[model samples]
Target chain A: MTAAADAPPTAALPKVRVDYLPMLLVPLLMLVALPLVGSVSTWVTLTVAALAMGMMIFLMASGLTLVFGLMDVLNFGHGVFISFGAYVSLIALGPLAGWVESDNLLLNIGVLLACILVAMLVTGGLGYAFERIVIRPVYGQHLKQILITMGGMIVAEQMIHVIWGASPIPLRLPEGLRGAIVIGDAAMEKYRVIAVVLGLTVFGIMHLVLNRTKIGLLIRAGVENAEMVEALGYRIRRLFVGVFVAGSALAGLGGVLWAFYRQTLTAGMGMEVNVLIFIVIIIGGLGSVGGCFIGALLVALVANYTGFLAPKLALGSSILLMVVILLWRPQGLYPVAKR
Target chain B: MLPNNPIHSLLSGDYPRSRVLGALLFVVLICLAFAPFLFPGSQPLNVAAKICVFIILVASYDLLLGYTGIVSFAHTMFYGIGGYGVAIAMYNFSPSWTALGVGVIVALVLAILLALLIGLFSLRVRAIFFAMITLAVASAFAILASQLNEITGGEDGRSYRIPEMLRPAFRLFDEPVMGVMINGRILTYYLIFFSALLLFLLALRVVNSPFGRVLQAIRENDFRAEALGYRVVVYRSIANCLSAGMATLAGVLMALWLRYTGPDTTLSFAIMIDILLMVVIGGMGTLYGAVLGAAIFILAQNYLQVLMGQFSGMLESAGIPLLPGLFHADRWLLWLGILFVLSVYFFPVGIVGKLRQMRK
Candidate 1:
């Protein structure tokens, strides 16, 4: 019995070491190696483009992952906040009379920063109002949440259409960042490059907030055990509102980026981008911010690949990716462990 | 509206009360059968048919959702498939008796096939998982339809030339005899209207059966029902298939009536939501609720815009275009949102559910 108890720990060991990230990184490396393949797999270009798009989606879904994972609200109306932010930022500088036109590089940077700050604030406020008035009554009930929120989504879009006609409003980017910059075979838009950078920066900030701050600690604590948090005397409902607002504001930030990147805004943009956004969040994992980030980028990369490589299968590719992910890992590639 | 909730009264062993309700329902059916003569306006008749078809849809959906407590968002996908089935049969085929039978049977079977594929992928996950899977599958089907421009006619959809229905007209005797003429707007309305009536009755019978009682039992508590040896997964799958087939029936009939088909008719979120709204508004978990809900929804929508326009003169003179402010011009989303808030808060059980409860 003693000899049996002393059985080697190495007995259960498998033949191969499973280094998962590099396994993932290999497909990614091969993806980059494609352009070198004489453009034979032109579809690879779309993958890169999709990866770029995915970055923006990741930011939106990052906040949502936390909110939905913690709170049961469907938040289908989250797309509106992004659109609203973009429009608000556009209005702040270009359309509204009180705003001064700033063509100088420093002033332009100031305006962009101001836009981000104000957009986040305004969208957060809107989220608070929505949660208080519309979402509060139907917290636990799933059906009511779905229907009521869906209606809110409809109202948000309609309001946009009413305010700005159905036509796409072209946004003016203060002179300097209009065209593409050639960077060794792949021509990249300065605006899109900025978007990718901003996305990473926000992700970093979120990690700091989640890991370092006291409120973040509470959020982590609440997400793990709600009853325990309430027992600890922290306001959980207030936390939910904060999360919803913050998540919604993140969507707004994405919208602002989308507006600048696209240099145009349309009322229908929210609805148009909705399916893709939700798909990213789902594939990324329901509750994990990091998962949403990767999922969004992954979807964008896949979409871009299909568009560049096989235009015929362009739209279907993301859906196919979603199907494969569900089959392979139903919970998503990077599900979050409890806080 | 009834005096109180029918469920409460029903629980108190008010057995005789249901018989009276049945007799009243019988009378309503007789009147509906003769409604064509009273409502002679072509517009009303056409609207009636459209309403009836939608009612059938709402009723079928309620069986899966309201009764089973599973919200199925891909009901319209089945409806779209049904449209394709009928259109394919009509276009590449004859108007022979065998052709119509083949078309109907194939549509029902194919609907079940699509439902099975969807159920296999989605049934494991409830709530958001189920909702998303259904939405994704439906959108995929819609996208596939649009992408296959040649087969699906793409965005424009397919137009079937329903050659002749000599055999069909003969069976009805008083039916619109000609093919193009019979299916022409006026006659199409009656055809759809009658078919809707038939499907609604079939739906009613199913809802009243012991199977429906089982469904309700599961809805109230799946754990308890499963504990009693009921296979929930199979039951849910069966309900989904039945709903899908019924939704297809409506879609096929509409394809026949409109003589045209488009993904917009069946693939849009609007269609799915509209069916849901109708079921809720008419009443959930009740057969008659669907019929009433559809009638109100389609009619109100058809007339409401016109009613809004009527106020144009007064508003225009007062320096407002009316639509810009109220309808929010291009965005009706605000209205939808507001109404949703109002409905959830004010009419939790929906119009039909409220009225039925009152009757009790």
Candidate 2:
């Protein structure tokens, strides 16, 4: 505050102060829903389920939001990476089915990690190729970018059919990861708990890396003003490519988790998830990860609660949430102040 | 020739050699109108009618994307609305011609209102934001349409009957005319032909009118257009409404043609992608390009699968196991997607724009 007050007139720098107001929407919503839900146990189960779901969504969305914020490119084909990740995880899981069926938690966890590693690597590599072959030509051209990326996604999805066959393949959860633990009359799925943990870990790591590291600073700076970062003699394009690759990897991670959560995978699964991902990103504000985290939670919680309360409105609830959010803050809940 | 005639046709003098291209198109359209008799089959007429419908659809898209420079993913929503409007009206009321007329009017009105609402709500946001908002809106509508099974028939979709006079079995003549049996299908095909042509002309008129130039100006430099005293938001909203209304008209025609309305054909995002591909492949900001793009794309979409099937059959016969499986007809989307990307990369201005550029 003193520095801001004492700052020279010519150097009126915008404060990087954290805004906590939007964060309150999450707790406020939870509190408001407690009475409507009535049963404490049901509310607990729903809340946990929503949190788990929100975490997975946040993991999926964080990458696209970063890419959009920093690179200012809308890659409508982002879903292909998610699909790639989910499909690639299957390859690792196929031979490891024995290990996955094991009663030993260590072996099951090991197989899952290996699958994640392989999925992330494959998707990250594909993301590199996607950028070079599809995205590179249409830089600064949003319309072309959208059309061509969609084309790329269509081709990729078809390729999935060519490889995986045109059928929805079911995936089995690891033996140890099955079933739920009851706490004080509230039942929480074991996998949901795992998901919540993994989601938080991802969020923490992302928040730390984005705020604490040199690359993170550059990314933040780039998001604010790429031209200035370029003028400062840094190769911002390489950083952007790295960001795109990272974003793709995150999407892949989310995909593997999502596949297990649903226990199924299909060629068009990514496209279906694409709609929800965009909704989350929009409600969170296009470029802000914190906003994305909160937005994801709000959307997921609302969806689960609404689904439980009024089954008919389940699908439309998230959309209604977005509309209400946009109505209140057209730019989003945590819109980055500038380009 | 008067070089500066104000009453020139829409494409006239817009590009070098455009008048010749326009004349060629007129001839092609005339030939297409008589295609059923000439070809002596419904297949030719069906394909031509489809092309005509898409020409109008793609042209209306060009108005939004090409002229106004807005990339809306919600065009299919309006298209679906138009389809559902007609389908529901006919399903609930009598399938009389008057009901069809009422359906068209209601669809158009509904489309305009929805477009206005969407435009006013999201138009203030940045370009990408608007796209995202529309995407959200479109997906929501699709789910709503599917979930509202009573009205939409859920995933199975709803089929409605057309007027008896327009049915394929309806006889127009008791005797053959010039060795050709005239039936209701032929009449309906011609109806599609003329309506599509009229709609295309109307689209051309809108794009050629001074109002369209303002849209172009907005596309180029919106702030500058506003500085020059144009109400940018109002014009944009009107463009949205016009584009939506036009799409709705196409939807109605499609419903009448197919006698069906459903989530898959009407509200699916896949259809939205198809429209985007048509507009982009045709050329942005060039009205004539829409016709060319739609014709080529629809032809390819219909025929490419057959071609792939034949190729795959040969490969299988030749004992190429893995390759044959990969080259099935159902995988046509893979090829279409690749072609879409290549078109954007190689022919960014689209076919007409490329020709115009070459002529210049």
Candidate 3:
């Protein structure tokens, strides 16, 4: 275990050296799907699109898995943060129509950043209140947590309707972020490329924080045993609150990206994407971040591939993936064995 | 005190004297059955019928969530299956009574099998994992139902003809009674009302039985229950099957009442959440609490919006403009959401449970 902990970020982790066979499923799936797709360019396009979608989902799901893994809270209301972030972004973008219409790349990017920041801040604040009010009392009770959080979600979605009305709001991409770039015979949407970059940056930062920083160490320790962490003189409760806030902020960021990805937002988009998010987290093995990342990618790839191959099966494909994965590894792809 | 044997207690009329709450529910059921005759309106009878269906549905959920300590979100999926079963059978086959009976039987069997499959498969993991899996499966089923447009009617949903006898034109008498027409609607209303009552009682009997006692033991502590020579998984699986079958029956009732079945109405996650709220607000383990919870929830859900509309009108008349929009009938869900959360926190034991506690 000590050796496993001390192992460098890359290569074989001693713990998974024996069971890393399941890790091959992602690549194997991609390889097998390539022939079925039958066009190199289309395959590239599908792969990029899937990766982009997966990254956006990971952004939303990472927080949920963290909160679930660390805090043991099944927040069915996480969708509200996503919806809230998307709606909050609209507040900035709605007025800054001129900036969005602008062709200048740097200025448009600047406007997008500002929207993302606002979304994160607002959602982060909301998460704090949600935790204090709806979540804190039912800390250890999973059923009540599920129920109350779901109730919180329903209210939040309705609140969105109240504020924004029932109409679907348009959130067009900035001029600089619109259209696609040709790479060989394949065309990749410019926004998707940007999303990939942003998603990777988020993942990199999370990986660094969870694995490298002192706070990350404390959090990791706390997830394993909060009492022990407190016994060792760390403020575990404060740490958890911070983690939750961070997760909510991540969901907000994801929401902003997702809104632009679809170029149209509705009140129910958050709830709609929630199933996909759960499938990702479940496939990723609940609490394991790296597993969640892989799980998200796998889900997106399967969904995209199946959508292109058989549209009717697309809706059930991710679920099928989850079931198969669970059959293979009942605990998930990378079960975090905390308890 | 009543006899521990639920059947004996029920037959002896000792149940009402001993269990005041049970007696109260019995009266409510009677009133609900004769509601159409008393009220003489379609709207009131419709609401009463809805309450009855929800009562059975919520009670079935209690069998799993409260008794077996399993929180399965697939309850609504079974409910949808039952509705779609009947709707499709009537759509393709005859709209005759035999077809309806066949549809109900097929739905019940399918629901039980699916429940067993989901329960056994997911129970291989932990409790929380099972919950998540059910959520995934239920949502998948909803999506599939919508996408399978030909048979399920897609978003428009399928509406089927009922047996001739059950149609509204089929009158019972040559003349009206108490200014209320003796027609098929009233007969259908009574049909649902009585079935709901009987199902509620059956649920009560099941929960009070030794099997239910074991389920309660599992809920209180699964590990301890297993330690006391119980196969926890097997018991949970049986409970899951039983609950799913009963929920399917409720779904059959829902389909019959609406004469329609759609993904939105039957299989939606929102309906699942509403069921959870109903169970929680009524009380978890108590069978009678299902009646209280479902009744209160359905009444509030149906009538609260009307009350809110009136209140909004009053506010508008008084020149309280902004508040009126917030209190509009459309925004009733927002208020319901708030109330649900508050209820969960403040009345964790639920209304019936709280009443029971107070009495003690």
Compared to the true structure, candidate 3 yields what TM-score?
A: 0.94
Task: Supply the global lDDT for candidate 3.
Answer: 0.87
TM-score of chain A of each: 0.84, 0.95, 0.93
Candidate 2 residue-wise lDDT, B1-360, digit = tens = 465676356334453356556665666677677877777876777788788888888889889999999889899999998899889888988789999899889989988998999899888666776787788888889999998988778898889888988898899999988777888878877888888888887777787789989999999988999999999999999999999999999898888888899999889988888888888777888878788888878888888789999999999999987787678988877777787788889987887777777667
> 1 or 3, which is superior by lDDT?
3
Docking quality category of candidate 1 according to DockQ thresholds = acceptable
Write the candidate numbers in order of decreasing DockQ: 2, 3, 1
Candidate 1: lDDT of A317?
75
Runs off by more than 4 Å, candidate 3: A1-23, B1-27, B316-322
Where model 1 places Cα greater than 4 Å from the true spot, the runs are A1-48, A95-114, A172-174, A262-264, A336-339, B1-36, B92-103, B166-187, B320-324, B327-337
> Which tens-of-lDDT digit does each residue in A37-152 have in candidate 3?
99999998998999999999999999999988888888988989999999999888877889988989997998899899999999999999999998999988877788889899
State which docking tier applies to candidate 2.
medium
Q: How would you encode candidate 2's per-residue C-alpha lDDT over A1-339 as one tens digit per residue?
A: 687678777885678687888899999999988999999999999999999999989988999999999888888888888888998998898889899999999898788788789989999888899889889888998777777788899899989999989989998889998999999999999999999999999999999999999999999999888999999999999999999999999999999989889999987888888889899999889888899999999999999999989999999899899989988987889887684
Residue B13 error for model 3, in Å?
9.7
How does each model score on lDDT?
0.71, 0.87, 0.87
- What's the i-RMS for candidate 1 in angstroms? 2.2
TM-score, predicted candidate 1 vs. hidden true structure: 0.86
